[model samples]
Target chain A: MSTSKFVRQGFPLWLLAGLLTACTTTTVDEFRQGETGIESHEAIVILGRRQGSTYETREEFVNCVGERVSRGSGAIRVIPEKEFVDSLFPWFEPRTAPLRTSDLQALMEEQVVADKIEEYGVRYIVWVDGQTETTNRTGSISCAVGPGGGGCFGFGSWEDDSNFDARVWDVSSFANVGTISTDATGQSYVPAVVVPIPLIARVEANACSSLATQLQQFVNGD
Target chain B: MFAVTGNRKTTATRSLRVLAVLGMLALLSACGASSLVVEGSYPTPAVRKIPLSLGLYLDENLRNFLYIEYTETGAEEYRVSSGQTHVQMFSNLLPAMFERVQVLESMDDAAAAGVDAVFAPSIEEFQLALPQKTRLDSYEVWVKYNMRLLGPDGAYIADWVLTSYGKTPMEGLLSVEGGINEATVSALRDLASNFTLSFGAVPEVRDWLASRQNVVSNQ
Candidate 1:
């Protein structure tokens, strides 16, 4: 191959390589930053996450909260998803958009008064929400030259990130109880990459425990 | 030609190598790429108790269902379908399942009748698993009852047929002697205990409320 030919071909390859490297590092840093902003809380109301027919994610959160509460100082009661659905009718249902502060306040007042009269001892209620994202990319090439300059080449990369955000509302008076968010992101240069299992697990467990602690404080009026 | 060909091959090979690495990385990243994120908040726990009042005759029946096995049939089936001979057996049994609360308050017929609300026990279904004749005719019964508490404001509380079951002796003279009678009673008692633990008023709450009232009186 002539020097000019090599330079022409190599320059783009070098640029692509630099871009790939930058993208990889940038994604990793983004993940780390995403992981950092997670806020902590003492108490939280967990809502249901559904896919077709399964609410596995929501169930997991419930279990996580239950375990954390069981280990902590205050009492914890899990409101069944059915009850949450019922609450939505009067508070979240009629609304055309995401809940407004006034709507939440109204819910708080109604629930608190009704609960106090019916349950007498109930002191608070909590709620939560979550979201996730994924992406993939690939490239390939093959070529052959007998007596001429000919060769085929191909390249590709894929990346994915998952995030979770949670918010809490006080049931007694519809106040913002607390909020938290956690994220786990990873990328692969190969056909496949091992997800950061340890990282996801750590963040989920930590966030749950942190929320439990916040709930304890709320109950304590701290 | 050789040098040019060699350089071309090297460049191609390097590019392919990078692609292969990227593909593998993609697969690896996607491999368990799925995540489970959970957020939960606690709700104020609700505590309520519905009293059972059917006079002494029904109360005794409830006690019997809690302690003894009658024949090889389960209490839920036997009691529910005993027909007119039993009349409203569940009405008799609902109060019995709540023996703990009644025991604590000594709520007699007069007190129950005067209460602001009452829950009528409704039967949903009764299932019986009986032992094969060779196995001594032992059988298990599962009974589901739906109950609704009516106040001046209409239905105030409801519980679906929470199931309870008992096993009884299937054969010999034991079946004739009512081997299941004891089992049915025990099963009923166990069911009652579980229900109370889950939804009944906390005993401590009652005590606290009483003490507060006493303090006010003292003041």
Candidate 2:
């Protein structure tokens, strides 16, 4: 059988192999361990995510950072997305008009940090950017395909991988504080919508914990 | 003929398998899509009432008759001016306050018609205090208002004072019309809501009247 024909015939072995190869191994040791280079800052201001139709999960990452920073000696603050937008450009309402990335970057550089320095007595700022991707694999067994080709034992498996990347910036000296990447995968089998196979939750939790731990290390300097 | 029939059956089976697989993919995608979730929460004041119209005078400069200009800083001046105009178009769109005031007045009128009580007009004054070093361009508005209840005795029954402030940063530009107008409107809405809550919570008038009637009966 021709390879293309084989692929068309629902043989996903090659695709699965490629995805497996693409998965990178990350270890605790691979992550930078200490904050030896970090300076003692008076405050930490968490940046809001970019504006879009959908809500961004960066706020979760921000809360994680805020939790970690509060344990340290620094005063932790979150600039309300509205206040930040108003104080920075005061012109572009993100609610109505989507802010361009370039414009956002410029506002971050010129308005946010400058005003924080002046009004909030902020000496240091922590800026975080986050993005997530997801993939899922499913299998089923059926005696016969139902309406619209629905059935089980027409065994099908799908594999999906999403990448979550976050970067933290230090405002005082305008340096990158740290960066983190995480991946989450999920899989399910048909005939039982109730049972999730339990791995999907574990995968997502592991990704969240890994990101949080990386940020904590940055905050702790350990 | 038999061989051709077998080939046709095999093809049908394979097609069925492909269709089943696609259905499974669709179900899986739907499940995964529904799993991502986000939530938000905001802090709300436990009690939102400020009592009104026991009077306190502000400096004459802070009175409502002053004309002010609004200005913008940096590159944002243009876009924000447009945004301000958009916001200003509906500046008086809060009809709820007027509705509530009308309802309250009607209730008071009914009460007076029954000779149970008399209704008196309440006075509200908003004041703005410019920060020292007048060149600094800081603006803060203070609002005060009072309400009193009078019965057949023509005596003061109850009263209270309400005050709140709104502040804006100092920009060198000399226009307060557009800039302070937005802030002032927002502050006034909040003030009105607070006043309504306080007015709804008045117990002193009813309690004092009850106590005085009891004393007269006992004597």
Candidate 3:
């Protein structure tokens, strides 16, 4: 091919490569310790663990996972974190929440707590704990407006890493049926010429989907 | 001659408008204050009420507690009015935990009348930290409470000091006032959770309950 023809052909390939690089890499792992299955009248509650000093399991991620797990084939009823926590009130508050399966035995002795749990027909408690962080930022785009006009002219990029872990507790048996861990990482770019165009990666969303899928399969005994 | 007067009047009117706008801007800048009120509501706890009539003394100081802080330059002021939230929290949790509760105007008035016990809850100390000031990722609030328990005869039974800490992650879009209010509400929830689950474990409280049981058994 001629040199001019070759150069023109390479531009599309470069663009394709840039688009692909914006995709996030995700992985989901599961560890099962007991049998898992849900009944027609049973529901699962998903709560985010927020005890970490430096990081918080974002509420948005918890809601996303709950919405995901509540739909599709073999879909089960899922209780929202806020509603479930509020329904239980002080018992499920961060300061008083049970940290171990064994603690539930003591908590259930409260009578009121046990009664409420039974009323909700909750069979599993899923505790999600994780956060998404953006780091390794590079490049910068500067834009200034003048009396005449203004435009951006530079490139900026950053890496996003999302790590999450979910533990499923069988309320009836007071056992941790299994645990799921998910991780997603991606690079985002903003190549500005006149107007800044952001090719952002959906790291947190990808991780949520991966985790929710695994949870559905695990709950259905797949 | 007519044109000159008309031009002068127009200029004077324009100048006055400009001065009025400047004055309003100056007033706004001079009053750089942040006042936070708790917009969140408390959730009722699911607890078996203790089978004892009680009198609760919620004093003015505890009902209208406000924390104020100013920047070193005194150009900006931060205020957290947590009194209403704390009052609502106590009101909700106490009724859930006790069979009968009488709101007392003063400790002396009802402490020795129509109740088996009198309970008084007060804020001892409250502290708040900003992310920029503490180099932390969250805004934090710390509260210390003095829980006073009294017998039917207005005699002091126990004075327990309880401490609670709560923090909310700082977000890029969350304002300082919103963060402060969130942390304060979190701290209030923490206090209620702790007091609810563990109050019976206190030795004095346990003893008082046992004594009441003994008296009831004799009766």
Candidate 4:
């Protein structure tokens, strides 16, 4: 084979491998207590656990999960976490939110809370707790500009891991119906010559998608 | 040679002017104080109201409170406008906890009519922690208040410090002012929730309620 031809073909193959390396790997684990199903009129609420001292469950991630769960035909109705928490006010604030299934009974005993719960027809309360962390970083890229112009010359790679768990509570039964946990990990690279090219990893997005899918199937009794 | 010297002198003068302008801009930015205002309407609590008409006195000190904290060298100032929002929140909170509340202007007015209890709440301390100081991704606020529960005859039933805390995560590009404001509102919500859930749990308040019950039963 001619040297020029071999170089062109090998370059495409190398780029393909780089792209594949940027992809995320996700795993989901689900545990259901028993047969589970949701009525069409009922709704679900996904809330992020935010009481930790070292870390907070990101609000954007919780909303992403909500959006993912509530898509497509015959999609489940979802009550936004903020709206539901505000409708109940002090009861559902981070400090006062029930930490266990048993606490739900006492919370529902309040007449106004009971009435509001009935009004929303909320069936499941999904409590998601976790954080997405940039695990490891390597290499460095530096750029500068002068009268002649400048560019970056470096190749850097970093890993991100997203691990999260969701606990589903059946509001009517006042019991925890199921739990689903998901984790996604990916490596991203930035290689620069004249300009920097980023092969970004969407580990957080991957975790959200799979968790939402598992939650939907678990709730719909599929 | 003369032309080269003149060019050098001009270049140096222009550079000095640029440096002076940059220094002035820095000073101006430091001197300008930032104001934080908390604004979130409190929701009516769902707890059963205490079955008694109450006299509520929100004093001017609590209504128009502002805290100004200056740096050690006094180069910058941080002001928190919290008093008005405190009034707004307590207005909703007090009504929800009692059967009827009469807004009183002074403690002397508490002696006027058919009121069984009175409450006067005041700020004790306010503290703010920025992310830069804490080396954390959160902006936190702590609010301390003296919750005074008084009898109709100006007797102190209970005087206790009710402290609440709140923190908001400062992700990516959120402004420090917005983060602190969010934390303040969260702390206010927390204070309302703490008061609502713990009112009957406070020892002095519990004793007073029990005494009131005894007197009613004896009657």
Candidate structures ordered by TM-score, highest first:
3, 4, 2, 1
Chain B alone, TM-score, model 2? 0.36
Every model: iRMSD: 12.3, 12.2, 1.0, 1.3
Q: Which 10-residue window of candidate 3 chain A scores lowest in summed lDDT?
A: A13-22
The sequence of per-residue lDDT tens digits that candidate 2 reaches over residues B1-219 is 999999999999999999999999998765441211111111122221222212211212322133222223322111111123212211222222122111122333433343433333333665544444255445555556555555534556677666544444444435544335434543443444444334445687558656756765787
User: Model 2: how far is A56 from its true place, Å?
Assistant: 5.0
Cα-based lDDT at residue B1, candidate 2: 100
- lDDT of predicted model 1: 0.41
Which candidate wins on TM-score? 3
**What are the TM values for chain B, all candidates?**
0.39, 0.36, 0.85, 0.82
- Give the per-residue Cα lDDT of candidate 1 at A134: 38
Worst 10 residues of 1 chain B by lDDT: B36-45
CAPRI category for model 2: incorrect
lDDT of 1 at B207: 48
Model 4: DockQ against the native?
0.51
User: What stretches of model 3 exceed 4 Å from their correct place?
Assistant: A1-21, B1-29, B74-76, B111-113, B172-174
Question: How many collisions per candidate?
Answer: 58, 16, 0, 0
Candidate 2 C-alpha RMSD relative to the actual structure? 23.1
Task: Identify the candidate with maximal DockQ.
Answer: 3
- In model 2, how many backbone clashes occur? 16
**Whole-structure CA lDDT of model 2:** 0.43
Residue lDDT tens for model 3, B1-219: 999999999999999999999999999867877777775677887888888888888889998998887787865488788888887888888888888988788877774568988988999999999988898878999999999898767798878999988888787535887888888888888888889877888899989888888987899
Residue A73, candidate 1: how far off, in angstroms? 6.5
